[model samples]
Target chain A: MSDDVAKFLDADIPDPTDFPADAPGLRQLDEALRCTMCRELFEAPVTVNCPHGHCFCSMCIRTALATKDECPLCRHAIREVHLRRNTAVEDAVRAWGLARTFVLQVLREKEEAKAATVASKYFSGKPKSKKRRRTPELSSDDEVVEVGERNVSHSLKGHTSSSSSGVVPCPICNKSVPMQNINNHIDQGCPSPKDADLDVLLSPSSKSKGKQKQEWSKLFQGGGAGSATTGSKKGKGKSRGADQDADPLPKIAYDTVTQKRLREILEELDLPTTGDRATMSARHSRWVNMFNANLDASPSQRKSVKQLMLELRRWEEAEEKKKTRAKLDAKDFDSGQYQKDNKTTFARLVEAAKPKAPKKSQSPHEGPPASSLSPSDGDSIAPPRRTEVVTIED
Target chain B: MFEAGPVSEADFFTWEALIMGPKDTPFEGGVFAARLTFPADYPLSPFKMKFDPPLFHPNVYADGTVCISILHTPGDDPTMYEAASERWSPVQSVEKVLLSVISMLAEPNLESGANIDCCKLYRDNKAEYERIVREGIKAQLGL
Candidate 1:
């Protein structure tokens, strides 16, 4: 069964060795060779050297590193040492030539199956995203508010992929998810092994005892990593007058409630409310002059304005992080990934290039069918000169 | 970034590499020392690696920097044969590149290389090139 499925995927992939012959245990190494965002073979794959697989594409990984050198997928510490190519894998590849053809047929078959499944669903009337499937879980359809602004109509269609049937039970752990989701699992997306009631990934001592050790360390000024990041700035960091200098334009209609709200917002960051008492008194005196400007808007509008600012800040930070990760992956992703193996060709190459016949000859049961389009171009790849076009793989 | 190379007599800008005759290939048991001169923009630009005792092969450059697709810099090349990924980039290190070079010596991608004379000699005039390669390997190995 494993051979069949492996053969299927390999049938098309140009470089068969790129996929782990034994997947489960080497998931991290496998994931490291691929791009996280693209969910395919990397154009320039980069590895995050974590004991637990926390791999991401180089470009994504590098962008994330700008904030900190942590793997984008699982936040593991990334060291330069992890950047070395898997030489054993490379040697196997140098020997393998190009990928096979049968793997492509299975992939194509899988695609057809998925297209068939999507067409049968009730939501197919309108083209909707997979996220919209099984809408609202509401019995009364009219009550459920559709997601979107006034102009756009929305539809929900849940989708299952084509490679659904008889996927090889993952060789590593007996457990198997779709092959497409393997990298995610390896890179933090995989349910924590500790999450399984059956297996304890880390012994209980490692978790609780480690936490206690951290707390003791924090007391000694070793502080948490976040604090350490702001390290060596004990004297020169924040200004001494920082607390007293905040909310300078105070008493502008500084009603008790408004003052409380402002205090609540500012206090989140432990900022100051006012300067000297004289400064406070001056602001209060000016309250008579400026109260209307502060209070003109309705309370909800003011609250909403604050919320909007907070939300915007959150989005901006997230965007910044996203861009950082993207840059990292771009910079590092696909560094060694050869360009010939896009998923389609990768699957095809794998199929075409399988070891002529694995030990036990099967009943020849018409293994898998060929692609409908008929690769009239034939099996040869664009000769070695054209070998450098990097393709993202799954 | 600068560490003394493994072999003595090897310089940083131009290091000496002992290319072991790949086992079972036509150039077997032959020890070939080559000169690898990295450009100022090396890792970005392809490094020039040439046999000290020059010999004939299809993919080798006239000056002896490897002309394999993997060694081409991923920049605008006047020739359209190589893709950006196939070209050399700063990310590539000496180890990976040497691996590719070794592969090229064994494989000799003849399609793109226009060294028709050397290629013809290699394919049709096999006995001659082999003898030359074998003798060059002898000089490089000091054997």
Candidate 2:
């Protein structure tokens, strides 16, 4: 195989470029809804309580604050407590989420229609001059029809019911099929009209929406149980009663906490206390950040405790690997220089170890070996010679 | 413009970069080959960058590690010379590091010199220092 590295980009992810070049306004609109830190469309977006009032994904801001108690964009002094739900932005994001796939499909159709029109004009035996003049008028009309209110209402109608000639994504396969043909398409096991782009755009979103609803309902139940603790616990005690409240977890003073106390805390959270004191403290702090961040998210968007725990474990594993790699690198970096720096200590250690072997043998049988050393100085010039029977013969 | 990507598809932790030396400096016209090794906890912790063949500059160590305040973490002020505000934070990225290093090449920070010989030559004999740097680049290019 060629030595050239594989070039890849996350081209599938919805980005500002999803809007065509002509729609710079729409592109900017798409960009405005994204979190700067994660560079993804905002999920559970929160406005930083600063003069700048910058918005970020709830998890993004919480993770940033955990590292440094300031805004990532403006460096304004901030804390997790300062974050407030930006419901206006949330609604905007939600509306955009539903509109995004529809817009993309419509845009794609419009482009195809333009291209087909252009091709027919070029290839057909029509007068070139006459065709050129008519093409502009035709294009302008198409733009007004496709991009204006008429197309949106038509698509919405098709989305709800497959009666009109307007296109709707097939429920089973998610391809943009003509509204009238959706039932036939599914009846034939979604065989044809293989529009992969629309499928890719629409299917994931529908799936995520379902998953999100399930998680929201689960969280809602847990929250309800938490509120009615006395009654709910009697029915089902599975609810994560510890973290259902709205209050943020108090920050742990990692430096002051004993290892035993930290391990106990980890155990209470059902977390692995496998790493050292420092690791345990770091893990606990990270868990707190994640837990509090989940609380910040809208109840419908909050992840389950099990999901959060899995994320924590994954993060810790990655971090632990990095730490071990760094340690190994430090040991391997300029080995000769490292040896030189510790040469004296190494020499002292060797010297300390030399006398211990002789003392171990002599201590079991010989009493007051120090006193015997002066009397046997005539033959005790070498310590090994004095312990010859044990050293070699024995 | 500087360009960088992973050296191999299997290993994202290490990246190879081609940085154009800042214009109007001794290092101008030199296309430096540098390696960026990112820790697993990247963006949270800054990556380590080094010139492969090593650059002869005061702020660059003989081993080619860049000695700039922006690359150093807040907890890593061994010399106690850099201010906390100037040090690396989560907000810093590879692009910022690249820009800082380019500026560093244009004007070396003598306060925290990495190469004592280069620093001394730069301070005591500016003409000789630039001449040596140019000659070194010429030798590297086999010109």
Off by over 4 Å in 1: A1-394, B1-13, B39-46, B139-143
lDDT by residue (tens digit), candidate 1, A3-110: 443444354433334344554433444444444443334433334587665444333343334334544344456754354333334322222211212233333444
Question: Best candidate, DockQ-wise?
Answer: 2
Reference-based lDDT, residue A39, model 1: 38
Q: What would the per-residue lDDT of candidate 1 be over residues B10-100, giving only the tens digit for each residue?
A: 2223565555556666667654446665443233345556665454568776655556766654444676877544655434456556667
lDDT on C-alpha atoms for all candidate structures: 0.41, 0.65
Q: List pairs with backbone clashes in candidate 2.
A: none
Span of 10 residues, lowest total lDDT, candidate 1 chain A: A385-394
**Per-model TM-score of chain B:** 0.73, 0.96
Instruction: Assess the local accuracy of residue A272 in candidate 2 as a C-alpha lDDT between 0 and 100.
Output: 59
Off by over 4 Å in 2: A1-11, A17-22, A105-246, A272-279, A320-394, B78-84, B123-125
